[model samples]
Target: MLHYFFKIYLKLTGWKATGPVPKDLKKFIMVVGPHTSSSDVFMGFAFRSVLKLKHIKFIAKQELFKPPFGFLFRQAGGVPVDRFNKNNFVDQVAEMFIQNESFAIALSPEGTRKKVDRLRTGFYHIAKKANVPIVMLAFDFEHKEFRFAPLFFTTDDEAADYNKILTFFTSVKGKNPELGLEHLLN
Candidate 1:
């Protein structure tokens, strides 16, 4: 219903979705990266709609679940997470995945629109513990295209995996100049 409408809207607009459909229906994690602006939300929403992906969920800050907007967030498959908590969010998410068996949780490794010293490693940890592959989603505003890279398997070498993930974002062009890697990672 609403998802179908959004998919049509995105097609009418300039946004394009390119990616591989999931082969396995089991649990998995999606890593959306180089998040640089509010537009990332719109783009991600549009992509999700286009894919017609049921059971897809994203983790958002708890504050975004306030009244009026809370319903909308839930409607769009958002799960509220308290970012300030010292608890093991990764393990918690992994447990959820294991319990659900069909869960596909989405996260922005960048953690915020602003630049950061390094990408948060929670996505990797969750995927590894859950024994699920990662689906890499990226937005190239300059090209007016959104790409879905092949599912990535977490390796023993975390740094190597991180570098591989970073390589995909290297060619993506964003409207904001500050979205470059300098501000993205330490």
Candidate 2:
């Protein structure tokens, strides 16, 4: 019931996923870029429903797991993080993948809903450590579409790998396009 409701909601809002989200790969990190608004989460939920994806998990602040809405978020595969205790966060996330038979996490490379020149690189490191490919998704507000790019596999040359993945986001416009990295978009 909820799946169809959310799928219908996405269509009502004129939002549709561009292509089939990769499903053959069971465990990987999904990178959604230019997260400039809180609505991104809702959009992602709708997108997931539209795409019929149920196993992808998301990381959120520990505080959000406190009360009424916490259960809802958790049911949707929300993992809580204690930002104050930043020790081995990447390891913890990687551990989630390691422990699970199949898991996929979605997070913004920018790390915040604000302007950023360079990506946080944490996602990259997590993928490398977990031995999984990074699935890139773009919230192209300019085109009013969500676009999925090719999966990125890290090579020994980190710089070259990062450069190649970063190029895929050059033309993508986020909710706040002005806040995007000029150098990156250029």
Candidate 3:
């Protein structure tokens, strides 16, 4: 099906996924880091296809669900969320995990492709609130590889956990290294 197509696409694009696949986990929050390019979405789709993890969904702004590219996003397991709303997104996304028998979502910790002072904590809070583990996914453009870390269960100590997460992703080089999280290591 589309999975095979995406797999072929990855090969054609000179990209490959390399890491341990978490096939046993029924639900978890996957944090993809160094999201320095819009092309990450297409690579993510190919990565998901290569890993055979089509069930892992992702959230985007409501506008991306509109015409033109909307259909493609929906087909790629995208769930639109209202970014302007006052509603608590963490709670809303946590509820999604509670309601589903098996649900996994991918989020970008950097939140934007631009350099940032620090990573967002929404993924951590959602994983903690939903009682699910957080998995780290790395986009290493230097190696042309999509890497995955094992299930990382959030602990009570937020700072320590963030340190560990940050350490894991700091070595990864993104499509746009200048805009990636490597600077946060300082």
Alpha carbon lDDT of each predicted model: 0.78, 0.81, 0.87
**Residue lDDT tens for model 2, 1-186:** 878898777677777667547777799999887687878888888777778677788998889998878897799889997777756778888888899989998988888887776889889889999899888888887877888877767889988887776787666877777776546733
Work out candidate 3's RMSD over C-alphas: 2.1
Question: What is the TM-score of candidate 1?
Answer: 0.85
Worst 10 residues of 3 by lDDT: 177-186
Clashing pairs for model 3 are none
Per-prediction TM-score to the true structure, in the order listed: 0.85, 0.88, 0.89
lDDT value, residue 80 of candidate 2: 91
Tell me the tens digit of each residue's lDDT in model 1 across 1-186.
767787778778777767786646567788876688888887777677777665779887788999977988887798887767776788678778888847898788878887767888999999998888998877777777778898878999988898888887766865574764544332
Best by TM-score: 3
* Superior candidate under TM-score, 1 versus 2: 2
Q: Rank the candidates by lDDT, best first.
A: 3, 2, 1
In the range 13-128, model 3's lDDT, one tens digit per residue, is 78876677777789999999888899988888888888878899999888999998899889879988887778788978998899999999999998988889999989999999
Per-residue lDDT of 135 in model 1: 88
RMSD to native for every prediction? 2.6, 2.1, 2.1
Number of the top lDDT candidate: 3
Model 3, 10: alpha-carbon shift in Å?
A: 2.4
Of candidates 3 and 2, the better by TM-score: 3
